[model samples]
Target: MNDQNPPAERRLPPLQLLLVSLQHVLLMYGGAVAVPLIIGQAAGLSREEIALLINADLLVAGIATLVQSLGIGPAGIRMPVMMGASFAAVSSMVVMAGMPGVGLTGIFGATIAAGLFGLLIAPFVCKIVRFFPPLVTGTVITSIGLSLFPVAVNWAGGGSGATQFGALHYLGVATAVLVTILLINQFMRGFWVNVSVLIGMALGYVLAGMLGMVDLSGLAQTPGLQVVTPNHFGAPTFSLAPILSMCLVVVIIFVESAGMFLALGKITGETVDPQRLRRGLLCDAGATFFAGFMNTFTHSSFAQNIGLVQMTGVRSRYVTALAGVILISLSLLPKAAFLVASIPAAVLGGAGIAMFGMVAATGIKILQEADIADRRNQLLVAVSIGLGMVPVIRPEFFAHLPQWMEPITHSGIAVATISAVTLNLLFNVLGGTERSLLTGASH
Candidate 1:
């Protein structure tokens, strides 16, 4: 008889649940709002419109998270998953905006169509699970972590566009936050240890505030209560070209989301079979479709939160469900949203290092169980990791590529996933060695 416990039963107490959920909210809030901020600016929106975009993104993201973490029929993965705006769609949406007569309405129209495309393709996408044994999954997961480190470094340097970016004070603050998290992890126990990242971020925020680095001016301007209305940017007008572009973006999101789901499955000790994988992808598609009506961008699993799950050792899906509630509340209460948004980038950077690093570490741990000593397997790992770094180190490396191919080569995670899956097929499956290796690894 099986003795393992299901994910739903690993619930935390009420207070612990709230705190842990808040930590997740803090970790993901920056990324959740980033898409709308970028797209809003690209579309030449006013300050008020941008704020509306942010609120709408958060509201849809919260709903998506609930669908992802708490199962609704066959739609959700029923695991500790957090859904948010996908960065993969940004480039395409921006391009659509620049096209005459497209703009924000076209973006939303394409988003809706692409989401429906994703929903139709999700079952087929799940079939790719067979290609992702420990070998490919490890490489992809490791690539995800490596790809995110640059973002953390940029944050540690006082964010990308800061006037004083990379200043000594910013680095110092980030280092202090990193050290605080490390110290807490070492000396603390039980709940304290679990909340180390939260405490670290809180301290870093305070330190940055003391240094006059934190900005609170926006909070005063933000309204106390805001409603997220559908089609706030005007009625969506679909075009074939934009819809096709967004469909490509959805394909990339599916690949990245697959890697994240598998990584989370490894972290929580859950078996992500084809059925579970299908449900997760379906939720992503459903939320993205909903996002179009809600004045938001495409939705997918947030990779950083997956790292948080590994770091905190809190595997309860209910925790993430509570986080969904918190996100909904924040979306409705703009003042509180702005308050959390006021946390300095340097503070997030410190906590991010630990959270993102754990994802890479988990991949390494998984790799250790694979049959990597074989020369073919070794080459697969080496080549996959190397090619994956191309987009990360030089994002414009594929700028000259055909527009249709941009979706495949633009993202580090997408590149890594392609490399890993293709190489595994060439060196293992086609070479007739994958079965033995997988069988051995299973032992």
Candidate 2:
């Protein structure tokens, strides 16, 4: 038999592929929704305002995910990747929210301008992929996980600024959700095992509702349907200060996307060439632009979903495209969207702990493939990861730093990426003859 012809046993049925794709959606749903909720609260929006923000975000995220997963002209990655709001822009949005007279319109304008900047620079940034070897990618991805953990912790404690934060019922629900996930993972098999997070979350939702820990007052108040009319916050008013801040956000997003693309490539055994990376970046930036126009935030690849893809071995981009469709449908149906919004924070926190932990695990798997026998490589990973953890462990450690420097110092992923790239260049790229010879020989 010809070498290719004998691979019949390796092919998957269309139905199996569909199921695998659905698994990916379940894994990423909670994470994709969290960003809008967090930002809406920070912006001091009402419950209705928060719901609108979330619905709009989901709609844009779905559209962006589709664009990224399914290639279009010269602007898509054509990978099994899901796109959502980039947390890197969270800090910038917070600052924008406080700008006098800027309001929501200013934020939207800045996001659109920043996205345009990202699109313009995408081709150039894609070329920097070569700088992210496995070691660097691993460190950055790990930092992404570490950075998000605190958000989960805050949610588990009933969300930040909550009057009932750390309430006994909230902790009880969180514990129940965690226990449910562990049980499902322990006993489930095949597809079910891969979707334990979803099952656990569903179970937690039901249990929390039964225990009176879940609230649905807002759901009842929400309208049955709502159309997302663009420019709802009045036409955007672009200003230099917010624009510059958002541009910085776009740069940070590009850096984070590079690391995420590397991680996805390694997990799927796919070659992320410069052209594909460029298209992916373009899609990300384009999505953010679209989001701004639709009254939302910056959009990019969901890093947590990368682990979901690896965990379930579901490499179908179509699945995420389908998820995008589901999200769009939710956005158009206010009642349905409100129902999802009604899921208790503790339930989301429980699911996040599992999913985020998986992200960190993926980074460890990548690190295992690196040539760590050399002490320098080990040191590179060590210093990078340690530096990344600084922000997570002590959120206020960099408070005294200059206001402009806050974005860079506050981001754990950014810090890790800088540390890893700088160290790798210093130790491996520009070392002395003896050090270089040793590195070469080890490789």
Candidate 3:
């Protein structure tokens, strides 16, 4: 027999729980609202409609968070997890929203159908966990971090559309924010260290505010204590192409969520057996279902929060459950969500670099156990990383490809995942040493 303590999902004091949960919400808030903002623009929505989309997105995200953290029957995973709108689905949604036959209604229908598809496949995905060895998962995660760098750079440059793109002060603000987080983490202790990101963001917000950068326009329009109604975009109209596109994104979500879940288990000392894994995935699917009706995009687990979990050494699911409550409030009180969004892009960039960089570093740490020196593994890592960069390096490289393949080709994570899985199968599962050599020779 072995002796060890249970995972960190234990209860904390009510006030402490509330504060910690708020930290988690604050960390992911930028990412959670981003999808709706992007899609709203691509959909050519009015300013007011875009604001409503953000509100609905946060509201539904909160409900989904509760379902995942505080399980119900065969649904939630009951883990210390927070769910948010998926970035993976953004390109497809943008394309569909801009297309003539596929507007808001079509997007919803596809999202709903994709959710159902994900729900049915979650069990099968859980059973196939062997395919994702550390190498594959690490590559995908590293790609996630790498792909986000462009976003950070854009933010630091005062966003791509800024008249003064790459302005010196923008970089200065981002650097200052980054420094603040680093200093807090180094000197702070216990809970303070855990909330260094939040503290850094707060400092950055104040700094930017003094520089007259924070925009209150969104907040001025956002109403307080508003109710989000279902099908706010009208009845969802289903179409085959968009539904298929969304299904691709759902598959990507399954893979990324599994990687995140596995990594969190390692961090929190939780053994994510197949049963628990399936339940977690079901929550993802259910959240997607809820997102569709609630005028939002699909939801998935966030890796940055996982990094925060590791950094803070807090594993309590209850913390995240309370976070769900906070998100619900943000949803109901549009002003609250607007307040978070009003944070300057440069400020968010500084914190985002640290959060997303930690995610990539986590992947590197996991790779420490893998025998990467082996030729097969080396090649796997090499080619997988290369494939991942294709989309990030040249997003338009696949533009000439058929529209049907855009969802897969445009996503750096998806490209990496496919490359890793296929390479792993050939090198390990099929015992293709000779084949690898021949392929290497041809190259």
Best by TM-score: 1
Ranking by lDDT: 1, 3, 2
What is the C-alpha lDDT profile of model 3 across 1-443, one tens digit per residue? 11133555577667667777877898788789889999999999998888788888888788888888888889777778889999888988998998788898899999999999999999999975677777777776677677777777777777755778778878888888889888888887866776777777788889888888887865665677788899988989899989998998899888778877877776677777788889999999988987899888888987678766766667878888889999989888878777877778888788778877776787777777777788889888888878888988898988989876776887777788788889888887676566668688432
- lDDT string for model 1 (1-443, tens) is 11256644487778888888989999999999999999999999999999999999999989989989988988999899998999888888888878998999999999999999999999999988888999999999999998889889888999977798999889988999899889988888879877888888888888898999988886777789999989987898999999998999899999999998988999888999999999999999999999998898899999989888999888889999999999999999999999898888888888888889998888888898789898988888888888888988998999999887777787889999998999888887876666667677542
Q: TM-score per candidate, in order?
A: 0.96, 0.88, 0.91
User: Which stretches of model 3 miss by more than 4 angstroms?
Assistant: 1-5, 14-16, 432-443
RMSD per prediction, one decimal?
A: 2.9, 3.7, 4.1
Ranking by TM-score: 1, 3, 2
Estimate the TM-score for candidate 3. 0.91
The segments of candidate 2 whose C-alpha lies over 4 angstroms from its true place after superposition are 1-47, 161-172, 432-443
Using TM-score as the measure, name the better of candidate 1 and candidate 3.
Answer: 1
The 10 consecutive residues of candidate 1 with the worst lDDT sum are 1-10
| Model 3, residue pairs in steric clash | none
